[model samples]
Structure formats: structure tokens, C-alpha cells
Target: MRSFVRVLLGLALVFAGTSHLTFARQEFRAQVPELVPIDEDTTVLASGVAEIGLGSALVLASRRRRLVGTVVALFFVAVFPGNIAQWLNRRDGFGLDSDEKRIARLFGQPLLVAAALWSTRGGSRQRS
Candidate 1:
């Protein structure tokens, strides 16, 4: 069950990353805070690349599953402010148009973090 959830999370990230690079680029831009130093497009692109890499690691890095999970959780944590900014600034993205929807979405992020950690738990180190 845990592995299944992890794979699902991985696939979701990959899909989101692809969206960031393509069709949903503009939507994702809504999450970029005005305070961000870099261009919004550049930030989106970089985050897309990162999501793809982290997602791939979650799916494929068996020996280092714990490490991958930790990084993925941290990644989720790192991006959380964007979610907050979107809500605070009244920026709509990913169909989260209303303040209610955006706030609900904010609550979901922690579950993603927990999923990443829970799915990768247990198991002794298998020497590389």
C-alpha cells in the first residue's frame, strides 16, 4: 500500500512538472510570489525540472528510498509558501480560484509531505 502511494505521488509530480513546462505554465505562474527574485517563468521551469527529478527519484531510487523521500518532503515544504502567497494575493491557479479553494489546497500539502515520508518508512539498510 505504501509503495503504491509512493508511486502515485511520483506520477502526480511528473504530471505536474510536465504541466509546468507546457500547458499549465501560466496557471503555475499564479503561484509565484512577487517577492521572488528570478523571473516567474524561469522559476516555474526550474521547479518543473526539480519536480521531475525528485519524482523520478521517488519511483526509482530503491536503495536510497529514505533519502529520496526526505528530499521530496523537503521540496514540498519549500514550495508551500507559493501556495500561501497565492491565497494571500488572490492569485488563482489550478482551478483554485476562490479563497476557500486556495485555503483548502494549502491544507492538502502537508498530507503530501506525510505521504512521502510514510510510504518510504521501514526496512534495514541494504548495503550498496
Candidate 2:
């Protein structure tokens, strides 16, 4: 179960990271917080790179799985503000034009964090 979830999470991250760099690049830009000092596109690119690194680590670094999970969970936490920014700013993108959907997404971020922690080293026995 752990291995399955871990790999699934890893693949999801990889897909999202690649999307950040390509197809969803503009969509992701909508989530950038207004308070962020950097250019929105730059923020998207930086986070895209980070997602790839974290995804790779989760998939390949068995010895450091716990650390990888921790980092990925933290990454989820870190990006949460952008979610809030999108809601508050009413910046619609990624088909999140509706407030209810956006609000649901805000709540969903924690689930990703929990999944990251649970799948890796939070409690499940380490496997692969």
C-alpha cells in the first residue's frame, strides 16, 4: 500500500511539475500570490523545478523517503498561500473560476500534505 501510494504521489508530482513548465504554465501563474515579490512566471518556473526534484526524490531515494515526504509535505504547505491568493484575488484560472471550487481546493491542499506524509515515512512501513 505504501509503495503504491508513494509511487502514485511521485508520478502525480512529476506530471504536475511538467505541466507547470509547459501546458499549465499560464494557468499556474494565476495562483501566484500578489504579495510574492518575484515575477509570477518566475515563481511558476521555480516551483516547477522544485516539484520535479521532490518527485524524483520520492521515487528514487528510498533511504531518504521520510525526508522526501517531509519536504514534499512542506512544499504543499508552502504553496498554500498561493491558493489563498487565488481565492481572495478572485483570479480565475485552471478552470477554478467558481468560488466553491476554489474553496474546495483550498481545503484539498492539506489532503495532499497528509498523503505525502502517510505514504512515505509518517507511519507506514518503508517499502521500496
Candidate 3:
């Protein structure tokens, strides 16, 4: 079950990252935090690259799953602020135009964090 969840998460990240690089690039820009110094396109592209790298790592590096999961968890936490910024700024994107949807989303991030950690043991040294 855990492995399945981890794979699901990995695939989701890849899909999202691909969206960031392609069709949904503009929509994703709406989620970028206002205070971030980088240009919106740069933020999107950089994050897309990070997501792909992290996702690919999660999927392809089974032996490195501990490290990859930790990175994925931290990456989710890092990008969380963008979720908040979306709500606070009331910027509509990804169909989260309503404040209610955005608020609910804010609470879902920790679950992603926990899932990553629990699934991969999050940096723990594996018993060989």
C-alpha cells in the first residue's frame, strides 16, 4: 500500500511538473507568491524542473527512496507558501477561484508531507 501511494505521488508530481512546463504554465503562475523575487515564468520553470527531478528521483531511485522522499516532502513544504499566497491574494487559478476551495487546499499539504515521509521512511538508513 505504501509503495503504491509513493508511486502515485511520484506520478502526480511528474504530471504537475509537466503542466508547469507546458499547457498550464500560465495558470500555475497564479499560484506564485507575491513576495518571491523571481519573475513568474522563472519561478514556474524552475519549480517545474525541480518537480521533475524530484519526481523522477522518487520513481527511478528505489534504493534512494529515503532521500528522495525526504526531498519530496521538503519540496511540498517549500512550495506550500505559494498555496497560501493564492488564498490570501485571492488569485484564481486551477479552478480554485473560491476562497473555500483554496482554504481546504491549504490543509491538505501536510498530508502530502506525511505521506512522503511515511511511505519512504524519509532519510532513515535502510536495513540491508
Candidate 4:
């Protein structure tokens, strides 16, 4: 049951992350034009691809559950800057729909990270 939950959670992350790639590109370009100044769309697309790949790896790498958990945790930490940017800059183009929703999305980051960590830990324990 724990393994099942872990895979489900991991797949959910992958789906969420993969889906955001396109939205992020469009929204980031509209909200923060400066991103283009750094580089072309290639960089943004690469980042999206990396996020999807990492999420997929977490699901597949069940044997190395600890490593997967650490990777997911680091990924969450790394993406936190974008969340803060959205919050501080009030980038309305991020598709958040409203200020309250945006705030909730921003705050949800840590919880999502915690969920990933918990899933990983819980799954690992069941294996032992």
C-alpha cells in the first residue's frame, strides 16, 4: 500500500510538473520579460523537461528511495525561488487567477515538499 501511494504521488508530481512547462513558458514570458533577456525559450523548455524527468525518476527509482527523496527535496528547494518571485512581484500572468489563490499556491510549496518527503520515507519503511 505504501509503495502504491508513493508511485501515485510521484506520478502526480510528474504530471503536474510536466503540465506546467508550457504554462510557465507562456506566463513567465508575459509576467517577467527579463527571462528572455537571459536566454531564449530553450533554457525554459530545458528546465521544464528536467522537472518532468526528475519526477519520473523519483517514481521509478523505488529501490533507492532515500536518494529519490533527497532529489525531490532538493528539486522543491531549487524551485522555491520562482515561487517567491511570483509572490513578491505579483506576476499576475502566472495563471494563479487571484491574489488569494496565488498566496495559497506560494505557501503550498513547503507542504508539497513535505508530502514528497513523507511519501518517500513511508515507502522506504514499508520495504524494510
> Best TM-score goes to which candidate?
1
Taking all chains together, each candidate's TM-score versus the true structure is 0.95, 0.93, 0.93, 0.74
* Candidate topping lDDT: 1
- Note the residue pairs that clash in candidate 3: none
Give per-residue CA lDDT, model 1, range 1-128, as digits (tens). Answer: 88898899998999899999999999999999888999999999999999989888888878878888999999999999999999999997888989999999999999999999988876565322
Task: Itemize residue pairs with steric clashes in candidate 1.
Answer: none
For candidate 1, the clash count comes to 0
Q: In model 2, where is the ten-residue run with the lowest total lDDT? A: 119-128
- How far in Å is the alpha carbon of 16 misplaced in model 2? 0.7
Clashing pairs in 2: none
Return the TM-score for candidate 1, rounded to 2 decimals: 0.95
| Candidate order, lDDT descending | 1, 2, 3, 4
How far is 5's C-alpha from truth in model 4 (Å)?
Answer: 4.0
Residue-level lDDT tens digits of model 2 in 1-128: 87788888888899899999999999999999988999999999999999998888888877778888999999999999999999998889988998998999999999999999988864455543
Model 3 clashes, total count? 0
Q: Cα miss at 111, model 3 (Å)? A: 1.0
Candidate 4 lDDT, tens digit per residue, 26-80?
6643333344345635545665676677778767875677667777778777767
Candidate 3 wrongly placed segments (more than 4 Å): 122-128
